[model samples]
Target: MTELVRATSGRSEVALTFHGAGDLDITRQVLAALAQHGAYVTVLAVGTWLAARPDAAKMVLDGGHELGNHTWSHPALSAYKPEPMRVEIERCRDELVELTGSPGAFFRQSQGQHATAEELLEAGKAGYSRVLSYDIDSLDWRDPGPAAIRHAVAAASAGSVVSMHLGRPGTVIALPGILTDFARRGLTVVTASKLVS
Candidate 1:
């Protein structure tokens, strides 16, 4: 599988990936907005988030989008020793597999940090084929206004993997404009797997 920082699809399509570790209400709003646009996205969910709200994880999959592992508690895997790093990756993979009945297709490092060589090997050992990083970060975590969020997403080009968060209300608020911008640019927003595949 490709090590994806940006999708390399030969089409005017991009992936909108949401990191799910924060507010559930905002997550629901984000999902609803995507559904309204008839857009499918990838959600890299925290294992603990899924454990606390399996229903939300189900909601993502049931909506016909893809869900992926984002570690157990959003820890920095690079800071940990090898064994604990494996646990961080594997525990999330296991939890997602149990909840979804399949090991997810991709793994994203916490905070959009690229995995180190050793960490990448650990991810492979944990059964993940691709480690997803992003080309465009929405910076929604800063509680930036909707306009700023829209501007960040607007800068994404074709085959871009745009990082966003489910924890922030600004992201939810910016969804309509983001979708509109993509549509206006004739860029179809697809799930990350679909974009890469």
Candidate 2:
């Protein structure tokens, strides 16, 4: 798979990627905030999350946002053998295809871990052409408060892929300021695909 840690568009744009599978309510809140700002993002969703709330996945697509696999469950894929790893990735892809009529164009590993070479090859075989990594991690998972989250994202430069999580309340709280900061800096937030394109 083509590994992209950052976009290459060279425009005043950054890609905001959210990893989902925890809280649907917060996910909706995040989506709403993004929509309110006319910003589009990429959500890497866990398969179980989609199964439990297919409507949430639909909500993302309906909002004109991009979706990708974050594995069947959030597991450290590198811990598994090659075949099991493939199962983890492909199961998520299958669920996405079944739900959305497409498996999406990118794959993001659980916990934002870097995929091993074998994992990358398996992901490609499963139909995802790109494995996405992030240049800036919001660390919102730590519930570091809105200010810290804002600071982390505000520091993003051009071509950055700022990683954030969907279930975290801090992320929802910090999104408005983050978007405003991006706009203030003359940056446009785009999807991962759009950033690379």
**TM-scores of all predicted structures:** 0.96, 0.97
Locate the minimum summed-lDDT window of 10 residues in model 2. 110-119
lDDT score, candidate 1, position 80 = 82
Instruction: Give the number of the best model, judged by lDDT.
Output: 2
Predict model 1's lDDT versus the native. 0.87
Q: What does the lDDT come to for candidate 2? A: 0.89
C-alpha root-mean-square deviation, each candidate: 1.1, 1.0
**Local error of candidate 2 at residue 64 (angstroms):** 1.0
Cα-based lDDT at residue 48, candidate 1: 92
Q: Per-residue alpha-carbon lDDT of model 2 for 1-197, expressed as tens digits?
A: 68889876689999999887677898889999999999999999899999998898888999999999999998878778888888999999999999999997699877545777887898988888899988898989889999999998887999999889998988899999999999999999999999999
**Please, what are the lDDT tens digits per residue for candidate 1 over residues 1-197?**
33688866578999999887776777788888999999999999889999888787888998889999899988877788888988998888888989988778789888545667777888888888899988888988898899999998898999999999887888888999999999999999999988988
Per-candidate Cα lDDT values, in order, are 0.87, 0.89
| Model number with the top TM-score | 2
